[model samples]
Target: MTGDAAAVAAERVAGVAGELAARVTAYDALRDHRAVFAYTYFRLTSDLAAGLRTNNPPFRAPEWVADLSVSLAAAYFAAMDAIDTWLGPVPDARPGGEVLSADLPETVPEPWRDVYAASTVRHSYVLEEVLFSMMAHMSYDLPLALRALAARGDVHHRIADFHRMNSLLASSVDVVQAEIATRYCRRLRSLDRLFVRDDELFTSYGIRVARGLAWFNCDRLLDPDASAEALGSISRSTAAFIAEFRSPDDWRRRRAFQVLRALVPSRRQWPAPAAPVAVGSSPG
Candidate 1:
């Protein structure tokens, strides 16, 4: 492709990736405290995997693995649906200001809009396969690791402090005008550390995003004469951040793209429909 055409493609990719990032990042931020946490979490991860897997190799994920992955994502979505039934919408349109609605390629703040935008692009599918779906599945899997700690009750009791936490978060945002003004840069840095991976998958993921941004970012800091150098720097920084935060745990080196590996049963086999009962359950 011509340099200009390639540049345009990169810009488009960046926009898509940015939207996906926004959704994923937003869900993660809200998942712990908001009523919408479950919904946002599943939706965002499902969408992310959908996008990432397209570039994934064949047989990297088998049928059973794929099915379970999709199911895990749906479970989170279902959990969100349940929350909506009992509680209510988590309020995507927070009261902070107009920062989220601002145009992209510019104006969009660092982490919030950027992450949500990434989630959106990841979910946009062309056919039967969805890259984000896998991500959504993986996202659900992350919390599932803690399910043993939460099995005492259903969603609400499991996430008992949600409302309080969300309330605190909401109040914090209102103190400022725009999201940028309100955003805790410390929080962003902290979370980036939490999810970033230096391994192959994460490295590739970061590179892809950086490449997308390089193609799209028209920031004055990236003049054509220095664009290559700038892109290299950005890519390295992203990779470094991602590597610093991630673990060998999420990389899936154990199973080689086996989706089931991400799915940890509460206390049984893969895709266990029901939770295992304790050896000493009372007689009916």
Candidate 2:
């Protein structure tokens, strides 16, 4: 990686403040929002920050949640700086002093356009799949987390949006990831006879997991006891599969199986039945 890449990775910002504000002002006004809402919000921001610092391209978020948060922040500042630099030349709108629209057209617009485009990347793609994966990841023991909270009873509007949008966003990312993984494997193995060893090769994969974790902040996944149970089962099954691979005898086989297993949730964590509709359903 380049020095610039390292610099970018080292960069940090306070997104937690924003998340907290949203929870207090916009999310469910009742239902002990602190217990369920704040934890998920903070967890998401924390995970997002970690993911960005450790991502490939030195800090590219493989999935859209982190991509949206980090890129939007970067894009916002970059655009502002560009605008400030452009404005620096202009002293005043004094008569005989011509304000140049030409300069604004040239330098200012391009950066802003780029920034705006970067900001909305998540809204335009599959995020649900990421949410689904995050729900199943073993790190949080999400099943226990949800069960501890028990049934939330009624769905709050903010929670509803979080579930539906996150799931859809993750779904988009999954499609892209599957396609990218296929190409990465094919080219690295047989298609181009290319050497596979590279430092950044695994960066994308890590970012994917990080963003996946952020997506899990969707409140619906965390509140529903059944969904949590489902996730718990999948996590255990995945852990079991990975354990088998840890033995020296199964190294190569396990590695290959890992790739195949990547798409499927751990069977142990996966619920045998569909989760109850506490909120509404996603569009078919």
Candidate 3:
């Protein structure tokens, strides 16, 4: 039984997501950043899909996976919208000669490209996936985005906005983990301790550290020497790091990463969450 077939099935891919992009791209003053914003729309959509809600946070999978994924989607969504506000549609509104500026296709840019490439690594722990994804976005993609636009009108504001959106993203982490992780711990009692450690590091400090790197990269973008070479190096190196980085083999401390990773849920057994139900309408 159906009325309009299209309406019956939600299109979550880029639904309503492009409003920010549309607003940003419409500013004639922001012509250069058009593609960057467009690609960002695609990513927000993708992450929305990744973290789509499910009844069971954990059968076998780690709970934080979906929460982190959803938080990132929301962060990027807010970040893009904030950029629109920051740049100001009125050409004469801000510094830097009238204005400042701001996908998913195989043709998309880096950091994100690295994220997509790493998407195939299903074996990564949920926290690992979260960190790696953040690294690619903050450290690689963002600075590269500013680099492409070549606008430094309000550098301080740019940094502030970056952190503001970050705070927005971080605010959700506590709530998500508190709710989902409790249930996940019940399901796999043995792994609860490992998951707890992951949460502590991630929430207490790991995320902020990564954000610091991202802000630093934004600073680098302002450099004339930071061109394609800089972006390329960051992208390549970050991808490799995401693939391989782990806690160090310790001294006699006996708390080794291998021990924690061994306790990580087997994707084979628990399986990553399924593709989420489409929730909203797609952007044309």
Highest-TM-score candidate: 3
Q: Give candidate 1 misplaced runs (Cα > 4 Å).
A: 1-55, 89-187, 190-284
Cα displacement (angstroms), candidate 3, residue 192, comes to: 7.0
Overlapping backbone residue pairs in candidate 1 total 40
Per-candidate total of colliding backbone pairs? 40, 26, 2
Error of 3 at 90 (Å): 47
- Candidate 2 residue 62 Cα shift, in angstroms, is 24
Q: Which stretches of model 3 miss by more than 4 angstroms? A: 1-123, 148-155, 178-201, 251-284
Show where candidate 2 strays beyond 4 Å.
Answer: 1-140, 148-163, 172-235, 244-284
Best by lDDT: 3
Model 1 agreement with the true structure over 5-58: per-residue lDDT tens digits: 333433343333343334334443453222122222323333333322332212
Q: Candidate 2 vs candidate 3: which has greater TM-score?
A: 3
lDDT of 2 at 72: 37
- The predictions' CA RMSDs to the true structure, in order, are 24.2, 22.7, 16.9
Evaluated against the true structure, the overall lDDT of model 2 is 0.33
What tens digits encode model 3's per-residue C-alpha lDDT throughout 166-188? 45345445543443233222333
Order the candidates by lDDT, highest first. 3, 2, 1
